[model samples]
Target: MKIKNRTLLLPLAAVLCVAALTGCTRTSYAIQTNDARTIISDGKPKEADSGLLEYTDANGVKQQISKTEVKQVTELPK
Candidate 1:
């Protein structure tokens, strides 16, 4: 009984560790606009409560752009 429990615990611990590490990882994204502008953000861009796509740029600047101005949003590979 003890050996069986230990074997199960090892895999469980490994899975939990993997999940925790991945959870901490964030994906960057490239936001393109109709005006030929590109913005890189740390995470996925989301619409603000005020109806604007708000995110922090790679330059560490806070930006709030309207949805009408955006052409597309693409996730950048790690």
Candidate 2:
């Protein structure tokens, strides 16, 4: 019983370890707005239609703001 349980847990443990390591990696970008507020993103903001800046935020949500409202966009140091 112990041997079988150990074998079963080995693969599960490996899967969990890989998931933990891969999930922790993310690219951080800082977006400064004209209003003096900063937004965090997981990727570089891109120009979108209707003069909008689009990006995926740190929480993994898709976001868009007016391009005119953004002061600057920069990637954060790793």
TM-score of each: 0.64, 0.66
Scored by lDDT, model 1 comes in at 0.91
Worst 10 residues of 2 by lDDT: 41-50
lDDT of 1 at 58: 83
User: After superposition, which runs of candidate 1 have C-alpha atoms over 4 Å from their true positions?
Assistant: 1-23
Number of the top-ranking candidate, with lDDT as the measure: 1
| Alpha carbon deviation, residue 2, candidate 2 (Å) | 21
Worst 10 residues of 1 by lDDT: 55-64
Off by over 4 Å in 2: 1-24
In each prediction, how many residue pairs overlap at the backbone (N, C-alpha, C within less than 3 A)?
Answer: 0, 0
Pairs clashing within candidate 1 = none
